[model samples]
Target: MASEFISSDIVSILLFMSPGFLTIALVGKLYGIAIEMEQFEKTVWSLIASIPIGIMFVYLNEINSIDSFLNCFLVHPLRSTFEIIVFSLILALLVSLIIQHKYLENLSMKLIHNKDDGFQTDRTVWDRFMQKNIGKAAIVETHNSVYKGWLSANSSRKEKREIVLDSPVIVYVHENGNTEDFPYGKQIILFGEDIKSITILEED
Candidate 1:
């Protein structure tokens, strides 16, 4: 009988406690994109953090009492659910903030941002320039050729190795500074594998 009771308690903890901690991390996201971490690692860390917080929540609420003792599922099932959710949310937000500031910066390693502005992100000089010059004309210089076009702002992802251009006019720059647009379609895609530099052209 004692072994059965202990097994039931263990099952209850596994079923409720595991998902309870996961809910906390999801709530902490505030409907934003979740951080790029391994799902297994995230869950493990969340559960480890949540255990003590869950205990504190139970102690504070005093939900466990003789009244609910007959309910072998948990000391106070309904109230415990509420406690888990609230505590998980609080801990989730706290841990997310710690990881954002203490562990990783905005997106890239070589980026600068204004702390006062929530959306002010400044990465490398080239990236900042591209962001500011979106829809404007620019020249993408590669190892063997150049492509001129309006910079597509959405071309770059944090770790992507390629970029996109709209209304592209492929051209080659001569040593004497002469340029002639090549016969090609309006759209051009360039890979960082061969790109040497990006120059924002003054002409429209």
Candidate 2:
């Protein structure tokens, strides 16, 4: 009977943490954040977040305290759980927007004395360049050829490093110093290993 009671308590604690996990996932998607953490670490962080969320919900709903909320949750599980779920969704979305817009970061920069202009939010140079110049006309230079087309998509992985170009025309220079252009109607996928340099063309 004691073992069964402990198991039930464990289950209840896990169930209470579900909203936190859901909020984390929602925030990641909406904010475009890459949550790089192990499952155990994520669970611990979620549990920490869940406690505050529950407290906030209790206060907002005019509940007496955490004890009252827990009692209501136990007595009316379905309705209370649904309300928590809805509140979590809204909270997650708001948090995601805050991260995405970098409002806090900007505020900090203004308040703090930081004059270094080298700071960038993107993880990599490729990401920064692509964010500003995606879908523009570009020239891709390979070892033996040059490809001119509109830049489509690029992979985020540094190891893979693949890029796609739309309606590319490959220019090959022969041994005779004659250049021949072969226009491909379909898109071309180029590996980073084969690419020598990429230049984004400006608006005419």
Candidate 3:
């Protein structure tokens, strides 16, 4: 009787542990996909953030069914499967939400604030630069200026292109700031370190 009781307790512990483990694994997988798609190099960081939350969920569930928890393992395999599926779905949703929020936060910083230009919210400067130069390519005349060029960043040779501003570059210009024209015979480059503000100028 003693041996049987010990075996049953062990089985119950395994059953309880299984659901949580499944939840973590499923969430982790979804997070991994999000990381790849978003190119966010913080998988380990996200996983670390989630651990405490997972533990809290497990503790809460255990507290609700302290007595017959172990018996849940032996009820039926289908029931166990169903429970795990539901838990995994919830975990996936949570992870996706976390990932999305982080992505938006990072994206927000890349936006330029130019309220006087009639933009209500901060707009991504790099995106606007691209839009402005869509038909006529703009060359980085200097760290602070862009000029019309025959070849835009898209068509330029890798060697001729500025490594910085690889993504859309956001420019922030102060209200009533001076807009400078792109000088001739100079390449434009917005080094990651040199970005102070973004300004849109009308061609004179």
* Strongest candidate by TM-score: 2
- Which candidate order results from sorting by TM-score in descending order? 2, 1, 3
- What's the TM-score of each model vs. the native? 0.53, 0.60, 0.34
How far is 5's C-alpha from truth in model 3 (Å)?
2.2
Per-residue alpha-carbon lDDT of model 3 for 100-160, expressed as tens digits? Answer: 6797555544443435555455334455565455534333444654433432443222222
Greater TM-score among 1 and 2 belongs to: 2
lDDT value for model 3: 0.48
Candidate 3 segments whose C-alpha is farther than 4 A from its true place: 33-67, 103-204
On TM-score, the stronger of 2 and 3 is 2
| lDDT scores in order | 0.65, 0.78, 0.48
What is the TM-score (0 to 1) of candidate 1? 0.53
What is the lDDT for 108 in model 3?
A: 46
**Which of 2 and 3 is the better model by lDDT?**
2
Model 2: residues >4 Å from true position, as ranges? Answer: 1-16, 24-52, 60-72, 75-79, 92-122, 174-180
Ranking according to lDDT, highest score first? 2, 1, 3
Better-scoring candidate (lDDT), 1 or 2: 2
Q: Write down the RMSD of all candidates, one decimal each.
A: 7.7, 6.1, 11.6
